[model samples]
Target: MNITIKGKVPPKAIIGVVILVIALALFLLKEPEKDDLIEISESDSIIDEKLEEGDLETTPVIQETIVVELAGEVNNPSVYILTKGSRVYEAIELAGGLTEEADTRNTNLAAILQDEMKIYIPSKEEVKAMEEQSGTKAGSDYIGGNTTANSSNQNKNSKVNLNTANSIQLQQLRGVGPSTAEKIIEYRNKHGRFNKIEDIMNVSGIGEKTFENLKNFITVE
Candidate 1:
């Protein structure tokens, strides 16, 4: 349908109308983009949090150290710091190595070090004195008391009298500590004097292995 108008529109009014249309279009397009950006930001934040949690789980923990006293014939005898699983030799080394007179033959250098343990290193002269008193040679199978005999008579007189020996005497045998020595005395007291050396095995904690180590050194007669 054709219609006739007799008025002219102002240039400023037309320009304002055009500007309003452009602004409305821009707002509609930007709204969806803003919503998309917000969603992406939230997802990135979640991923970053998950990564941080993973890093924490994979982090390594450090082990704690132990303190021990290293004494005896070492050059420097004092309390030293060490890690777990350290051996006696390491402790000795930390103490500035052994002295010239230190006798290492009796020391178990390969033994594991314990906290507050005292590693006493005896002198060579002291070991010799002990050997002379024990009657058997130093570092021999015989443990505890003094013995004196020639090589031909060594084994004959070196045996410990199990029936008559007290707890202190019993502790002189290799592998016989205070607890094991006490057990032996207790067993002997309860069951009467051991009739045979094998009867020592009847004591609690004195197993076959202990008996094996002690058989040569002990006697009932």
Candidate 2:
């Protein structure tokens, strides 16, 4: 058959034009080349790997916190979460500090702190009882309980704060009994706080001999 537009067209020529159009359409709609498909797949795989690995190069905002527990003689005894590298005093301050009956003579207040550690502040009466049972003064200046294992002793070991020590704490000093501890307290109340450790001699009983024995163990706050 022949179709007329401007002139008559032969069947062979019409068939040739139709075949060319079909070939162009087939080429446009053909599946992508193997190389193109592989490139797309590789890009997607890279993105998935980055997502899975959490983009380690990009610094993630991670919070480094530590948990500590405080018990006995503090105003509030409980577990506390603190910033990493926090010390024992920070935990105590967070727990509202020591109570009136809290005995710190045998405690290492300057000790560094750690995670999952438990700090126990013994009571004065409990300390006295322990002393009585042991028949000697408790020599250990470490806090009683499960403390940090890997913490370095960075701070110098603390001595008793003379200006702040109570009667019981003062009695823990060498050559100071209950009566002498009271006398020291009385002197503090009348004349005011001791300016230095050497001033303890004014307490009526703490002479040069006693001061020599206890000087190494006491400190002013």
Candidate of highest TM-score: 1
- Tens-digit lDDT track for model 1 on 168-201? 4466688887788667755653455578888888
Best by lDDT: 2
Model 1 alpha-carbon miss at residue 169, Å: 10
- Model 2 quality (TM-score): 0.36
Per residue, candidate 2 scores C-alpha lDDT tens digits across 50-86 of 9898886766687778777898789999999988766
Q: CA lDDT of each candidate? A: 0.66, 0.68
Minimum summed lDDT over a 10-residue window in model 2 is located at 147-156
Model 1 pairs whose backbones collide = 133-146, 134-146, 134-147, 135-147, 135-148, 144-172
